[model samples]
Target: MKKIFILSALAFSLAAVAQNQKQAMTKPKTTPNKAVVYQVFTRLFGNQNTTNKPWGTIEENGVGKFNDFTDLALKEIKDLGVTHIWYTGVPHHALVRDYTKFGISNDDPEVVKGRAGSPYAVKDYYNVNPDLAVDPAKRLEEFEALIARTHKAGLKVLIDIVPNHIARKYEGKTNPAGVRDFGADDDTSVEYKRDNNFYYIPGIPFQVPTSDTYKPLNGEKNPLIDGQFSENPAKWTGNGSRLARPDINDWYETVKINYGVRPDGSKDFPQLPEGFAAKEVKAHFEFWKDKDVPNSWVKFRDIALYWIEKGVDGFRYDMAEMVPYEFWSYMNSAIKAKNPNAFLMAEVYNPKEYRNYIHLGKMDYLYDKVETYDKLKEVIQGKTMPDPISDIQNGLADIEHHMLHFLDNHDEQRLASPEFAGTPEKGKPLMVVSATISTSPTMIYFGQEVGEPGKEDAGFGTHSRTSIFDYIGVPHHQRWMNGGKFDGGQLSQSEKDLRDFYKRLLNFTVSSPAVPSKFVDLQKVNREHMSYDAGLYSFARWSDKQKMIVVANFSWLKDSFFELRIPAELIAQWKLRDGNYVLHENLYGRRHALLKVVGGQGTATISIKPSESFVFTLAD
Candidate 1:
């Protein structure tokens, strides 16, 4: 009897060991902390001036300086759960402000967008914007100091890289020892050259675009605003307008950079290999390690490396799809070689090219505008139900992690704008969905938390979208700034509560285990069996040690009460047996629901207020 007992004990121990090994093999890999990006229009974040005058100069409507980003401001931003801060409009661009005394030439008002210029129309890749510096002569030093301060605050930095175009009067006064300005050595006699920096119309001179209602400086009298700027051997417009006299709608303020793609749409550089899309970033780097590329490609590559050396953490490429994919493969590979974990994001709108940009172009993230943002906007406006979101997620399952989600940015209308959802409260549930839906990074514009409506009709930009072209104070954001205290001192009670919700949601999102874990669509099953409303969306996320059920109500007028169900397949995957489990709300921690699992399936009675969301975790 003793021998039989010993054999049985030995068999039980061996079985337990085998099962442990199997479970370990099947467990999901731990993912890194999710990145939460806060994109601040650098010039607008710290400005306290409330005088939003139309066609205002920097003195009339104050501009935020690099020195204005005090340590307190950065700490406040970091405490809001932001891992990265994208300081937009940091590079030297053509502005009406005079810096000619500092050896920088005056930009003709006819060629500049506003009193403060469009940040995308870069005038110098080697210098910082003089308008953003307290001392224009020490602009670069001031920017470097800001970068150091930002890092000391434990936050990463991101800046823009507009590769496809540049300000028409391109000038780089502070190029490195061996670097030269773009088009310095180009042969302007031909329209297309394998090594030329720009495409030219040899016999023609560029003409300023004519408009009936628009004028430089809004017709304010200035010597340089004579509607005639000189450009011999006319170059193609930034938007690919081939005419010497482009239409008023054309991107007339900028010139297109040549990447060896001729006007006939033929590539002059080496094409990527057939299976290169599936290869790793290192392999792409190796492919371009010694190969010769176009002059424009080398210039942009050098520019990126230069910024990286300045302690800039990453770049947000503007109009990345307009540039060739092959160049991105080369450029991004070089960036990664310098900093292995550099955050590379881009603005690629075409859904068809999303995979190509992410895989072949080696981009870390692409804007999820056309698919996710557009659909969510419709749901927010009551134009459609939330049922299509699951289909969109399913379609991009393979590359979902590469998609970056945002509701507002420099380009999009503000959430509180009259044209959009029209209220800050409507964004609560939408933000919850945008942040918790996947492992992708979540981004919030500077004033999004306190609900800044882009309603100021600042010159050159009307309502619905905040002005990127003029000097204007963000009223709602300035209230939170509270005269540079960064303490939200002047915010109303409702605004303060909204910001608190954002802080809680963002902090929880970055650290939650279920955010980057396995996600299962619970919408279909609930709709079929539990009579779930179309105005609500549901999903489940879990790991070996954590289980979460996320339900969001998109309805603005009606609260929802329903029996949220979990299918047998998910319960089996979760390794749960017949039992009663308590699920505690993770966001507010004020609510708890009892989940009963019988016959391998589970059901929970859930009641969510209108425009509210709940993230319920299995209680220990």
Candidate 2:
């Protein structure tokens, strides 16, 4: 009788424990820290040249190498709260420099853009850029070492994967055994083949564009500049131009890769079955296990896998929407199969295809340039009101976590440039809003924090965006480089202050647990109650244990104080005791305030400086 009673009591205890564990699992989980990406043009990060002459040769203007990212440099980046280092233009792209002595084939001058050539015009898939290596013969080895070092620094690596097109001259010299070069097995006789690598314009010869604004070698004479690139049957341009000679403004230096997409706007391969959007990466991989994709899809998949195997953590697919989503379904699934936590982001612009790419294609993130960055730019430029930010957040509420926000990138103008906000200080408010707006990742160009205006007139590249096709120097960023000491010895006081602000903002976002939690927009409520103007925007981010009120004053010249009102509904939802509470400021630690709540309504008087932002955290 005693044994039976003991067994029954133990069974009851086990059942109660199981019930408690099940309830715990059903509760909502707290979100972790958001990702902060630091994008650096590998060829420009370490260059200390001030000579930014138009079309300057590498001998005249210096070029940065992979070895430049020493341990100290990476540690400095990590200290800035960066989680990933996006090394742009790391592959072996088309360049004017001759590497013939290294057994590499020469690229035609007529078909190449700029003196250094466009980074998007890739030459070899399995090799690194010779210009980015101290010794051209050991470029690949050096790149592998860089990848290893990046991993050792506790930072993930992201490199570009331009799948929509490739350089006019595509060769796989360093490919592994049994790996064939693109177009090697392709049939050039047919214009449209499901298996063909490129679209052909039969019976037509490739011609260089006749533009008065551009010269093959910037009017510099060269033996290779014959004004003719021999292609019996010309291929379509990278921008989908089917002309034998593409327009100068088009992507004339690159040829589009055909991934079973016919010229008639029809697909040659099988499309995803219905309801595939509801599946996971594993299911997607299984669905395509016995399937046959196009040869181009396989080639790109192999390319991505090659980098992933080389210790590359992720890929930023260039113009991802230009390629079919089906190919992404196959390629990204294969990548996930290899590394489930791979960071797969893409440059997808179409809002219509956003969910399809994220859900069905298994992309981890996409460029938020159109909805988030563009709206933020409008507010900064005084072209639009700040009210749209709330709408943008609501519109993308479902996939806000998958949109990556940024103020500057290679394709956009620098914040300090005259073409942009005309000063880096204007970016302070913008950075705060962009970073804390959603659960999305935030990125910044290498020199953006130090105010690299990119005013240098690089050949074949103009103002606004940084030049990815020339040997030019970034003036402001060089000061921070400090002659490769990886210190800010030469930075001005104001520049140092700005960098400090960026460090604080990024580090806080990456370390704060409340950032990825619930977000409540205070714009509408503050606009009505506090008499806040269109130049001011406010929002609240909170978790069970922490809360923050973010306010950004976009006014270029106005400084004012306003009563920040917390709505009664939110107060009730938070279940806070109506009493006096102290709030601590995150930016400037000296700013603290007392919050007064009466009958479920809370209000705090806060002062904001002109073109400044305040991140206030609730303190117990």
Candidate 3:
């Protein structure tokens, strides 16, 4: 088995080299306004607690309110060159906290994940999470004001829409008039109904799993901390598990939201017609206009439209692959018809369905985690070669502009966590590769810039992913928050320096037209040139008027100087002949290099320190 794995890796490496060589010979197309998304966990962004109790409650560890995104905070994020702010955990979800006094529903502690809740297990689609507002009754108003403030700061807003599932106790209290709640008109007797919102297990009652390693609210005293949850007939788990009494690890708090897919894995609703992939949003909407689709499909579409009407510029769909593509086609088409430029991004892990989701579903972007991010993570961890970057780009060349790139999000661990890279500085090269390699959107989690290690064991979530399931404060991010000032007054020198580096890099990408220009990988052609290893990657990005070369060293232990030989193809593309060209490096100030083109090629002595990245502009 080991031998086979090694041989397969070797074959892939060879193929990647060939692919890069072929790609270098061709030219890349430039895009416009490459989006930079700043994703923040709304509940934790403004909290300032050092005592990270494992299973902390709302009173024990206070949560951040929607009002916390002050004008100064929004301006700072905008100044970082962020075009969109993904406000995570905004929608009301099932939680252990009681808000019954505010006319809100109380989630059963046995079913909820932690003191807070899993943001994916949305309890209500039309209302904001009460915990996020200064007053629980004014949650929706607070969120609307936040959206207006974000737009005022010259940034767009995005919130999550989990189309595949909803909380076990689903309700739509704040839903607009004439809207029917989920399961209100379902036929409970039949196991398979086209209009049913959830699949039922017939006569089984849902039982909470008993685990020695886990407890509701960490054994804290609560009146509703019972071991039983009421479901007349247990439904399937979020991951599609059919067990009535799901295991402790199953997503028991949520039930799958059916979209006309029957129990036998066949589509009950009309599948998208042939060649629908090449159609526009209007065409998609027209096709579904007269078709008889399931109720769940229309419900989700109305839910999305409600938010759009409430001033949300876009939506980030959770586990989008789990839902049928036909539903997305209908829903996204309606969304686009309402707002043509609304950014619709989804979490799709399968590479096979990339084109289908983007073209047929009318989605603007999809997560590039499977190909780009996973490969980059391996490179950052020193387990693989970085030469495959060009391979990834070429593999998804047709849809490259639609692949969203990121190093950290709510699902992923912090870049500086022990489980990932032990130092935040390791992210320098990775971030450069992520931001500059493709014309797709780039995203950074809120605390990622300041090196939040996410070491807090906040209730249901362990060390790694910052907890959305618990009411806990992020320590490193709190220092940057500095008691609601949103300044780095308490940050260390190193931390401040890291943040400054991020600021410069982020702002430069948003302002430079070169970022959206054609990209050329130079490392493949210069492998044998002066100590260049797999840890050092280089590329060139250029438009008709703006052009720049970037080199990033992923190695943390060694610094080396090398002669970066610009390929003849790139030299010809730039129309350089034999005269000397002056080049100025961004990180190294006024230090310039004289590149003399001979035989349609140019060379420069590039001195890159360990974990350093440089951007060189041609000064003519």
> Which window of 10 residues has the lowest lDDT sum in candidate 1?
1-10
Off by over 4 Å in 2: 1-32
lDDT: which candidate is best?
1
How far is each candidate from the true structure, as Cα RMSD in Å? Answer: 8.3, 10.3, 7.8
Candidate 1 per-residue lDDT over residues 258-338, each given as its tens digit: 999989999999988899999999999999988889999999999999999999999999999999999999999999999
Any idea what lDDT model 1 has? 0.87
Error of 3 at 600 (Å): 0.9
Query: Each candidate's TM vs. the true structure?
Result: 0.94, 0.94, 0.93
Model 1, runs deviating above 4 Å: 1-32, 529-531
Q: Give the alpha-carbon lDDT of every model.
A: 0.87, 0.85, 0.83
lDDT of 3 by residue, 300-383 (tens): 999999999989999999999999888999999999889998999999999999998999888899999989899988988999
Candidate 3 TM-score over all chains jointly: 0.93
